[model samples]
Target: MIEFTNWDILRNLLLAARWTIALSLTAFIGGTIVGLLLTAMRLSGRRPLQWLVRGYVELFQGTPLLMQLFLVFFGLSLLGFDISAWAAAAFALTFFTSAFLTEIWRGCIDTLPRGQWEASRCLGLNFKQTLSRVILPQAVRVALAPTVGFSVQVVKGTALASIIGFVELTKAGTMLNNATFEPFKIFAMVALIYFALCYPLSLASQRLEKKFNGSR
Candidate 1:
C-alpha cells in the first residue's frame, strides 16, 4: 500500500479539483449558449418552434445525467465516432444544464407584464426587436440571481462524471481511498472541498437576490 500524508492527499485532491471546476465552467458556459437559443425559440410565439424547444427541454430534463453520460460516452462510439469521457461528460452536462436554464429564463420572461410587449409594439418594434430591447433587458435582471444559484447545482453535478471515468474530484478521492484505505478521511476532505466550492456561490446567489430586490 502506498502511504500518503494528509497534506499529500489534500494536494492531490486540490489538483483534481481543477478538473471539476473546469468541467463545471465548460458545462455552464455551453449550457448558457444553448439555453439562450432554446429560450429564444421557446418565446418565438410559433407553435412549432416552441413545441420543438419544449420537447428538447423535456428529453434532457426527464432523463438522468448518468444515463445521458452513458449514451454520449458509449452510444456515440457505437455510431463509430470516437468519444472520450471528458467530451461525453461535458456534452451530457451541457444538455442537462441547458434544459433547466432555459426553463428558468423562460419563467423569468413570462413574469413580465404584458404591457411591456404592447408598449414595444406601439414603438413600432417587431417581435425580435421588442424582445431584444425591452423584454430581455428586464428579464435578465430577475434571471441573474437564479442563474448564479443554478451554478452550484452545476458544480455538484460534475461528480457524476466520475462514473464515466472522468478523473475529477470524486474520482480522485475514490482512487486515493483505494490506495490509502482511508475512505472516511479522504471522502471527508472531498466533501469539504465541495462545500468550499459551493458555499460561496450559494452566498453570492442570496446576496444578488437581496441586492436586486432591495433596489427594486
Candidate 2:
C-alpha cells in the first residue's frame, strides 16, 4: 500500500474540487437556458407545445439521474457521437436540472394572482410581452428562493458524475483511498469538503427565501 500523507491527499482532493464547482456551474447555466425555453413552451398557447414540454420534463424528472447519465454516456456512443464522460455527465446533469427548474419556476409563475393575467390582457400586452414585462418581473421574486435552493442540489449532483469515471472530488477520494488504504480518513475529508461547498449555498438560499417572503 502506498503511504499517503494527509496533506498530499487533501491537496489532490482540493484540486479535484475545482472540477466539481466547474461541473455544477456548467450544469446550472446550461440548465437555466433549457429550463427557460421549456417553461415558455409548457406555458405556450399551443396545446401540442405544452404537451411536448410536459413530456420532456416528465421524462427527465421522472427517471433516475444515474440512468440519464448512462444513457447519455453509453447510449450516445452507440449513436456514433463520441463523448467524453465529462461531456456526457455535464449534458445529463444539465437536462436533469432543467426538468426540475422548469417545474419549480412554473409553480412560481402559477402563483401569480389570476388578476395579473387579466390585467395584462386588458392593457394590450400579448402573451410574450406580458410574460416578459409584467408576470415574470413579479414571479421572479417567488422564483429566486427556489432557484437558489436548486443550485445546492446541482452541486451535490456533481458527485454522481464519479460513477462514470469522471475525476471530480468524489472520484479523486475513491482513487486516493484505494491507493492509501485509508477509506475512513479519506471519506471523512471528502464529506467535509462537500459540506464546505454546499453549506454556504444552503444558507444563502434560506436567507433569500426569507427576504423574498418577508418582502411580501
Candidate 3:
C-alpha cells in the first residue's frame, strides 16, 4: 500500500467533492426542467396525461435509488447503450429528483384555495392562463421552502453514485481507505464533509419555511 499523508487524502477527497457538487447541480437543474413538464402534465386534467405522469413518479419514487443507478449504469450497457458512470448517475438522479419534485410541486398546487381556480374561470381565463397568472404565482410561495429542502436530499443522494463507479466524494473515500486502510478516519472526514455541504441548505430551508409561513 502507498503511504498517504492526511492532507493528501483530504485534498483528494476535496477534489472529488467537486464532482459531487457538479453532479448534484446537473441532476437538480435537469430534474427541475423535467419536473416542470411533468407538473404541467399532471395539472392539465387530462386523464391520459395524468396517468402517465403518475406512473413516472411512482416508478421512480416507489423504487430504491440504488436499484435505479444499477439499471441505468449496467442495464443500459447490456442493451448496447455504452453509458458511462457519469451519464448513468446523472440520468438516474435526474429522474429520481424529478419524481419527488413533481410530487412536491403538485402538492403545493393542490394546497391553493379551490376558489382561485374558479375565480380565474369566472374571469374568462382558460386553464393555461389561470395556471400561469393565478395558480403558479401563488403555489410558488408554498413551494420554495420545500424545494430548497429537497436539495439537501439530492446532495446526499449523490453518494449512491459511487456504487456505479462514479468517482465522487464517497467513492474517493473508499479508494483512499483501500489505499491507507483507515476506514474510521477516512469515513469520519467523509461524513463531516457531507454535513458541511448539507447543513447550510438544511438551515436555509428552515429559514425559508419560517419566512414564507410568517408571510402567509
Q: What Cα-based lDDT does every candidate model obtain?
A: 0.94, 0.94, 0.96
Q: Per lDDT, what order, best first?
A: 3, 1, 2
**What is the TM-score (0 to 1) of candidate 3?**
0.98
C-alpha RMSD of each candidate structure in angstroms: 0.9, 0.9, 0.9
TM-score of decoy 2: 0.98
Error of 2 at 164 (Å): 0.7
Model 2 clash tally, residue pairs: 0
Model 2 regions more than 4 Å off: 214-216
- lDDT (tens digit, per residue) of candidate 2 on 1-216: 767788999999999999999999999999999999999888787899999989999999889999999999999999999999999999999999999999999999998989999998999989999999988898899999899889989999999999999999999999998898889999999999999998998898899888999475
Q: What TM-score against the true fold does each predicted structure earn?
A: 0.98, 0.98, 0.98
Error of 2 at 19 (Å): 0.6
Off by over 4 Å in 3: 214-216
